[model samples]
Target: MVFIRWFLGKCILLINALTLPKPMLRIKADQDKVDKKTQFFTLYQFEACPFCVKVRRFIRKNSLKIDLKDAKNNMANKSELVNNGGKHKVPCLKIEKLNEKTMWLYESDAIIAFLAKETELS
Candidate 1:
């Protein structure tokens, strides 16, 4: 079962890489603003997770420049996700707004929605 899952995960990753989506075009100034805003956001994910891939596709399509943390392999990232995020889950988003408490958001759909609304990329 583990081997099967790993194989499927690799296949999914390969397909995703092969059929990359085109990013939305934005003027340099506007894209720079978006990039600056995304500086406080970090996405914690397993590379091969389908949901993570979905969110990644959205980020790529929208041209968002959020940072990615490998929660599956990186011990520190995994610990942060499990401790601060309060769960062991992929596609988790760490939101750190200025003058506001940090938030850990889960679910690929919710993450995508929040990013779309925040970046105004949808």
Candidate 2:
């Protein structure tokens, strides 16, 4: 079972690398503004999870530069996901606003939708 999972993970990564999507082009000022907004977001994910990959592909294709925290291999990240985020789930998005409470968003489709709405980059 472990070997199968490892093999599938490697295959998924290879496919992701080969079919990497190109980012959409934006004016310098517009892109800068988007970057500023993305700085407050962090994605907690496992490198090989298919759902995580889906969110990552959308992020890359839209040129969103959100931070990625590996919740699988990194113990600290795993703990944070479980404790603060209230769940151990991949593709979880952590949104930190200056005066608002932090938001922990889960599920790949929901994450993608939220990102699309927030960044206007779907």
**Best candidate, lDDT:** 1
In the predicted model 2, the residue pairs found to clash are none
Residue range 16-119, candidate 2, lDDT tens digits: 99999999899998898889889999999999999999999999999999999999999999999899999997889999999899999999999999988888
- Report the Cα RMSD per candidate: 1.4, 1.5
Write model 1 residue lDDT over 52-94, tens digit each, in one string: 9999999999999999999999999999999999999989999
Please give the CA lDDT of all the candidate structures: 0.95, 0.94
Q: Which ten residues in a row have the lowest lDDT in candidate 2?
A: 113-122
Q: Superpose all Cα atoms of candidate 1 onto the true structure and report the RMSD in Å to 1 decimal.
A: 1.4
* Model 1 alpha-carbon miss at residue 77, Å: 0.4
CA lDDT, candidate 1, residue 9: 98
lDDT of 2 at 80: 92
